[model samples]
Target: MSTFFFSSSKAPSSVSSFPSFSTHSSSSPIHTFSESMMEGRIENAKPIITKWNLNSSSYTKAISVFGHNRKEAKELLKSVKDLFQAMHFLVSENSPSHKLVLAQTLMQIAMERLEHEFYQILSKHCDQLNPKSVSGQSSDESRNSDNKEASEDEDELKRAGKTITEEENVSQLAMSDLKAIAECMISSGYGKECIKIYKLIRKSIVDEGLHQLRIEQFKASRIQKMNWEVLEYMIKNWLSAVKIAVKTLFSGEKVLCDHVLSASDTIRESCFSHITEEGAMNLFRFPEFIAKGKKSQEKIFRQMELYEALTDLWPEIELIFNYDSTSAIKLQALSSQQKLGDSIQTILYEFESRIRKDLSKTPTIGGGIHPLTESAMCFICSLGDHSEILSEIFAEHPPRNSTITETNIGSSTSNHSSASPASVHLAWLIFVLLCKLDRKAEPCRKDLSLSYLFLANNLNFIIEKVRTSHLKDLFGEEWMSMHNKKLKQYALNYETVAWTKVFSSLPEKSSSPIPPDAAKECFRRFHAAFEEAYMKQTSWNVPDGKLRDELKISIAKKLVPAYREFFDTYIMMVNGDRNLEVLVRFGPAGLENYLSDLFLGTHILLSSSSSLSCSSSLGCIIR
Candidate 1:
């Protein structure tokens, strides 16, 4: 016999069919009539069930009543509600066992109709229910956008009502349709069917979204074997991908799942966890996978980049995957962060070891900035830029034995009391660099003054680096001031060794008269010592401009006035003597001009003449 599932309008007065039934006698002819009437009631539920069935011959396509026909959608929803009431009455009556079978079949048909409708709405409304839209619309808001009758019916079923949209946002309407069908099927005890379809479809959306973002399911082994450029590219893609995935993709899925399956927390959590967990774990596990590869200075920056990404997105991750079933996603994210931190720590240790173990004997020509000084400071300054992130990492893995401060200055100059653990570690690394540089200077000691120049150059380079980069803030004012003083001391030591012979050639005080014979002797010694020091210093360089100028000015202040005094006091004594030019040499203005040519990082020749004279403002020129 044909059956007819009654829509809301055609539903018979048999709406009272869900009432508990009793007969005057336990076994009577009236009870037999009840069975026949119940059997008719069961048959009537089949036409709408069969014709509107998702797989029926007449409607094989996925045309959702919810999406295209609000009238049919409302009728289908009413049919399912009535079917559940019939199923309840059959269970309570315990008679009409065959009609109970028929009722079960019709209920299955109604469930199938609603299930198809649920799937159709979700599939066709992908644009409307996209991650961006779903995230902003709450379940209550979606329900509020439902048709007035549908909204009232859902309030009875779920009471999911809220004021979120002033206008008819299409996403809200789409979500509302999905929610209505979901509640209908779930209340009919076909939640598993509804959830199964949901997980399959939504999981694919998540997977496809990830693929579009260029995120791969990177295994540790696969990522390790990949070329670094390829790995680095993927990391950049992931860095961009993770924010969208966490904040939008998975987050929106969670919001939608929580709303559509609001009738059952257990079902929704299971549905959401199954749909997105695997993809999310894979997303977060990417850093851990990369971290499993070799640790080197080249890879450390990427690892820290990954660490920063995870740390930055952790709050959202926790809140989205905030279910017991979804805890593994959080665990995976945390695991990746820890592994990246470890990789960073290993690379730093390797960096430190390289500095400590650098025993290369090559000294930089011109006593300029050394290769080690440039490389080590460049690396340390880069680390300083990320010190805020590293501060937390260093808290977990602090430097070992950073307090060994038996430096040439006799104590640790860096004051790390107010510094972060990151700053402390960087300061310790710089200390190690200073010690290495100290050892490096030994090879230059053949020229004791050159050795001091080497120290001055390197220390000056270090101080300038600290001044210009993020390291300045991290190292603090005290660290910079202390290092500045050390650099000045090195310069002072260089000046003392280099200029002593020249200064010694002249009398301690330039004063009164002198005989031409003694004046000639004094001038001869002064010319030889002055030319020697100036020629030597010209070959060396102070790369920093400020330091170089200061050194030049300091030397000028000392030598110019004293020698001018010597020249003025003794000139007349020698002027009248025979071969007087032998006792007279450079004029005071010429001496000052010659000093300007010093520290040019190139040497100018000076003639070893019997006498030389001040030629011009540019200094004495050898002929």
Candidate 2:
């Protein structure tokens, strides 16, 4: 007695034909009739048996058919449904054949049905899902609205019994069926399809504007379920994709460096150009702004925030591009290096140039400082932590001679010999600004004293800035001290070198009175020196009143006593021999008055004969 499971070309047969249920002895008529009736029912259902076999190839063919031939898939689905119902009634629940066929057929039907439903939904919503379909409207809004419409259409289809609702479709899938489908797809090397399916589902949910909400729900569910392995796998894949994209984007160091430099230029121009007097005041005077009002201050603060954002962005880019590598290593592994130093230098140079240009347009006041000075100082201070890196880049550039060096004015050796590269670079930037200011003052050269005064004021401003801010630390305490000393020395140099010549006309303090010819010659020389010094030094300026006063007093110390003694002695000789009034050109009072006119940036010299007359009288005093 054998049971038969129908194959594609075979008719269904009974579970086990009653082996000639013996009508002899104990065979009950009721059982015999029941067995015969069951066989008859099985045979009747045989003609409607499905033509498809229960195998992987058949399952694959059915799925393909469902995707392209919906009508045929529907007929097949109905047949499979009928077949499942018949088998439940006719075959024993414990039969191995029944169990195998039931499991395989159920999974195949479920997968095919899911694919079919997905395609149907896609077709109906094609216009909404297609990005090209909606040209003018906001895509997200359009897609969301379309998704709602699609869901409503799906519900309508369900009500009409033409399609399954999403909930119903999902309910048809058992855990075992899903596992079987996954295993089959993976074993067949169609694992990527699984990912595609997941992405499609995500896209659909996102288009419906429910992605974020769903993700939150999923996360909450996952915490309770705790499927760590699946979560970890997903995270690993995501991270790997991100890493690949980063590597690709940063593949060329030169390109990356160029992009960074370009970005830096843009940021510098935008931020620096907005630095007006009011903006700068807001930046440096935060407490003042708070006390006053902060509305106008917001824009300035936002621009400042750009610098902070760039600062944060820079380090990450540096790390990824391996910018910390040594120069030798970069040369050897040139393919891997980013040439970060070149980019850094480009940025710094642009910033320096900007500062120079801005400061040129800035107005010079005796006591008040230009806003750029404070802004620039703040910018430099921001870079204080980057000093080591900046210093290295600065060291690579050769130092150029500046105005201080060009004029043969002496600066302290400590300023150059002991200063750090960063400090020197900062000093160079300031000097360039001063040089620009001097160029603007060139027209004032006719009054050379005013030009000099322009230089003095700007230089003094720089010295004070360095001494007061973090620039002092960068440029060093010695550097600041040296700058201050250099300024004083410059003042003294102007006085002694330019003014002393005027006093040189005095005759040597002689034990014997000079001859009349010698005294007359001394007076002539004195007149020339006094006129030259007065004309030259008066045009040159010392803008600071205190400084101007100090310079005048210094000139007086050198010339007053000498002129007085020469006058007293010469007056006696001239009084005895010649007219003392004719020889004595100027007395201590007149000389002191002349010295007082120095550094006022004025042209206070008397006419040549007037100057000579003034000198000739003093000429007798020496005699």
Q: Can you give the TM-score per candidate against the true fold?
A: 0.84, 0.38
lDDT assessment of candidate 2 = 0.43
Off by over 4 Å in 1: 1-51, 54-62, 130-148, 151-168, 404-418, 510-515, 576-583, 608-623
Number of backbone collisions per candidate, in order?
2, 15
Candidate 1 matches the true fold with a TM-score of: 0.84
Clash count, predicted structure 1: 2
Candidate number with greatest TM-score: 1
Worst 10-residue lDDT window, candidate 1: 1-10
Instruction: Please report the candidate that would top lDDT against the real structure.
Output: 1
**51-108, model 1: which lDDT tens digit per residue?**
6754455454335566566666777676667656655655656665776767766676
